[model samples]
Target: MSFDSRSVVLSWTPPPRDNNAPITHFSIQILEGEHSDWSRYQSISTQNSDLKYKVPNLKPFTVYSYRVVAINRMGASEPSEPSYLMMTARELPSGKVRISEAYSGKPDSIFVSWDPITQEKIHGEFLGYRVFWKAREEDGELSRQADIKNPNQTKISLSNLRPYTAYVISIQVLNPLGAGPSNTVLVTTKQGVPSTPANLSVTSVSQTDISLSWYKPEHSNGKIIGYRIYYNHGRDAEIYTVNTSSDYNIYNISHLMPFTRYEITVAAITASLEGQRSQPLQIMTDVAGPG
Candidate 1:
C-alpha cells in the first residue's frame, strides 16, 4: 500500500490457501467525502492481485481513504487497511502568454524559443519549464524532460526528425514539485518546393535558339543544390527540361526551328529537391537573317 497527497495505490499477493482452488478476481474500494460504506469503485480479475488508481482534481489539504480485497474460487480475503491521507499540490501564479520563437527550419530538425517564468512564481521555490511536441505521425503529445531550474535561456531545438512531415508543439511551466499546463503551436517543414533562383536573365538569343543564365540562391544552412531549366516556343507549345548542378548557370538550346517564336523559364533544384518554377521569359527567335 502507498499514499501520496494526490493518490493511493495498493497491491497484494493472493493467499497460499488457494493452491488447489482456482483464482477468481480482485477489487478496489474508495471511501471518500463522508462515506462509510465500501462502494465498489473498481474491480479486476483474480489474475491481477495488484491494483493502482488515482483521483484527480481534488482539493488541496484534503484527506482520503482507500482499500483493496482479493477474491478467488475459495472466497474473498479480509479487506486491506483503509489508507487515509491528505494531498498537497504545488502552487503556481498566473500571467500573460510568454514564449520563445522557434529556431531555423530544417528538413529534420527545429528549434524552439521561450522566456523565463516570472520570479514571483519562484518565491523561495525552484521552478522549471516543460516542452511538449507531437509529430504528424503520432496521435498523442510527447513531452521533454524538465528544463534547468529557473531557466533563463529562451530557445530549445528538437532534432533527429523525419523529413517532409508536420509537427505540433507546446510549452509548459513547472516547479520543483509539479508542472503547469502546456502552451500549444504548430509548424510544418519544407517538403515539395525548392528555393527561387537569383539573377536570372537571357544570356544569348539567335535565329535558331536562345541561351539563359542565372545565379543559384545562397542557402546558408547547407541544403542540397541543383537547377532545372524549362523552355517552350509559346504558351501552347510543349515544354522541355534540362537539369544541372548548381554550378551551371548557362543553358543553350540549339535545335529550335529557325525564326520560330519561343518562351523560356528557369527553376532551381536542390539535392533531391524540386522548387517552384521561375517566371517565364519570352524571346522570339530572330527571323532567319538572309536565310
Candidate 2:
C-alpha cells in the first residue's frame, strides 16, 4: 500500500469465520512510531469487515507494525501476527478527468485533450503524467500495452489508429514511489470508408424482375445506414439505393426485361462514407413468372 506524506494506510483480510461466528468488530494495535500504543479507535472498524485503517499524524521514516483481533459474542480472539513495514511518506495524484476534446488529427491519427491533474491533488512529489489508451473492445489491463508516458503534457496525438474505430483512454500520475489510479475515457476516431460488402447473390429471379440479397462487409467499422444496388444490362448502368433505418439484407428489383441477362453488385454505406462494392453477379431473368 502507498502512503501519504503524513500517514500510512494498512489493509488486510479478516480471518475466516466459516462455520464459526461472524465477526462483530476488530481491535487494532500499533507497536511503533511516536504514538506506539494500543489503538484508540474501535467503531472505526465498521467501515468494513476486510480490516483496514489509516494511522495519521506520525513522523515519517519510522518502522511500524500493526496487530489486529476479531471480536464476537464469545469475546475477542487472540491477535494475528503483526505486519511490519514503513515508507517515508511520498506524493501521488488523484483525479476524475475526461477527454475534453478529441478529433482526427490526420488520416491515421487522433488528437486527445484532458483536464490537468491539479497540483494540490498531488499528495507528495510532482513527477509526471501518463496517458494510457487501447482499442475499445480490447481485454485485460496488462495484456497488450499502455500509456503515452508524457512527463508534463496534458494533451497527446495518438497515431496509427484504425480508421472509424473506438478507443478507450485514461490518465494517471507518476512519482518516484509508483503510479496512481486513473479514470477511463471512451473516444471514437473520425470515419473513413467502410470495408466492401461480401457474398452478393440473386436469391430469386422472375420474368421482368429479380430478387437479390447480400451479406454485410467484413470491416464495417461504422454504422451501416443503407446499401446501393448496381445493375447493368449490356451498355447502360442503373443504380438503386436502399435507405435502411431498420434491419434489411435483401431487395427486389422489378421492371427488368423478361429472359434478359443482367449484372448486379451491392455496396454498404455509412452516414459519411461508402464502402467498396461487391463482386458482380450475372443472372438471366426467368422466361415466365412463377404461376
Candidate 3:
C-alpha cells in the first residue's frame, strides 16, 4: 500500500472488503502539500501485476503524499491506502570538478589538466573519476568509448598521437551507486614542421605601398591555409592577409610606408588551429624626395 523508504514508487492492493471480487482498475492521486488540493490522478488497469509505478522527474528535496483507490465495473470502490509520505529524486551527492585545459605541448603528445572539486556540502563519500574521449577525423567522424575509470591524478599525458588530428575529452565522477554523465571538452594536436615564417624580402617599395614575399619551408606535414602578416612603423601594428595557393612557394605581401623600415612576420593557420610564427622579416623602404 505504501513505500517504506523515500523511493518514488507507488504500490497498492485491493481494500479488505473487495478482496474476493475481481478489481477492475486502480486510481492513484498526488497532493501538493498538507492543505493543498490534489494535482494528479492516474488510473491503472487491475490486471497489472505488482501494482507498482515509478514517478519520474520530480523536484529534488521536496515532500509528497499519495493515495490509492480500487474500482469495479459496477461503480468506483472506496480508497485503499489513504495517504503516505514520499520524497522525490535528490541531487547528486558529489563535488563539482572540472577539466580546465587540454593541449599539445610537442609534436606527438597531448597534456590534460583539470581543477579539483571543492564543494564541502556533499554528503556522499569521495569517489574516483570516469574519463571518456573520442578521436575526430578531418572528415568529421566521431568515435566514443564507454565510461572508463580514471585515477585520482589530476593530470595525464596522452602520447603516440598522429599529426593534424583533433580529439574530444570528457570526465565524470563515480561512486558506489554508479557513474555520472560526462562533460565535453575539445583539443587539437600540432601538425607539420611547426609552421614558422621567416626571412621576408621586400620585392618593391613605393611612397604609399610596398611589395613583399617570403620563402616557405621545404617540407611540412600540415597544410597552411593562410598567413597573418604584421607590420609596424610606429607603436601600433598593422595587419594584412595572404592566401595560400599551395605550400610549394612564397607569398607576396603589398602596401607600406615610404622611407620607413617595416617589421613583418607570418603565422600559419590550419583547419583547427594556428601554428607558431616564423622568424621576423625587416625591410626599409626607398627614400622619396623632390623629383
Candidate 4:
C-alpha cells in the first residue's frame, strides 16, 4: 500500500479459485481511525483484470486501512484480511490565528496577545509565529515583520512607534511548509506630552497689562487641551500662572505693576501631561500716566 496526504493506493492478488465462477467485480471496504468500523467504499469491475485501486479524498494526517471482497455469479464471498494501518502525510495548516487583546500600554508602544492555534488545525509540525505591523496611514508595502521562533510565546510588544498614532497588526502561525491565514487588529498608541509652544512674543502692552500671542506647538502628540502662561515680575520675584482653553492662542495678563519688566513663557497641555515651555520673552509694561 502507498499513500499521500489525501489518497491511498492498494494492490492485492485475486482469490485462488474465484469460488468456481468467474470473478465479476471486487468490493472495497475501508476503516478510518481506531473507532470507526469497516464499511464499503467503492467497487471495481474486473473486465481489465486490474489488481490495483486508488482511493481518493482521504483527509491528511489520518490513519486508515482497507479490505477487499470478491463477487461472482453465485454471490459475494467472504472478506480478505485487513491491510496494515497507513497514515497520510502532513499538510499546511487550515485555520487562522485569533487575536484576543490589542491595546497601547505606553505612549510609544502597543501590546498584543492572542490564543494559540489548536494542534488539529496545524496539520504539519509547529515552527513558530510571524507578526506584521505598520502605521495605519502607511501602505501595506511599508509594513514591518517579526518572527518569533518559540511556539510558547503568544504575546508581543511593538515599540519605537509614534505617540497617539494608529497602527495595524497581524499575526500568523508558521510551519516548515508555509504560513497559515492571519488575523488582524487595529490599535492606537497612548497620548504623549506636546512639544514646546512656538513663537512666544508680546503682542500688545499697557501700563498695567500685557497681551501675548503664540503659535501652536509643532508636534501636538494629542488634542491640545489648554495652554499655561507663566510670568514673573523679575528674576527673583514670585511667579504667577494663568490658563486658557485651546480655543484661544492670545492671553491678556492684567493687574501688573506699571513700568516694570516681566519675564514670560508659555506651555501647551494635553489631557495626560504638560509639555516643555517656550523660550522666555522679556517685555516692559507701559509707564503710569498723570491722572
The digit string of per-residue lDDT tens for model 2 on 83-173 reads 6656546544554444588777554577878776664455556566667777776676442234544545678788877777777767677
* Candidate 2 regions with alpha-carbon error over 4 angstroms: 1-4, 7-88, 95-99, 103-109, 115-120, 123-127, 137-152, 162-165, 245-248, 286-291
lDDT, candidate 1, 172-226, per-residue tens: 6765556655666676654435556677788788877688887765431224355
Better of 2 and 3 by lDDT: 2
For model 4, the local distance difference test gives 0.82
lDDT of 3 at 261: 79
C-alpha local distance difference test of each model: 0.59, 0.70, 0.60, 0.82
Model 3 over residues 17-40: C-alpha lDDT tens digits?
755666666766665444555545
Query: By the lDDT metric, which is better: model 3 or model 4?
Result: 4
Q: Which pairs of residues have clashing backbones in candidate 2?
A: 91-124, 131-148
Instruction: Tell me the TM-score of model 4.
Output: 0.78
Best model number under lDDT: 4
Ranked by TM-score, top first: 4, 2, 1, 3
TM-score of 2: 0.60
Ten contiguous residues with the weakest lDDT in model 4? 40-49
Off-target runs (Cα >4 Å) in candidate 1 are 1-192, 218-225, 235-240, 271-273
Best-performing candidate as measured by TM-score? 4
Worst 10 residues of 3 by lDDT: 117-126
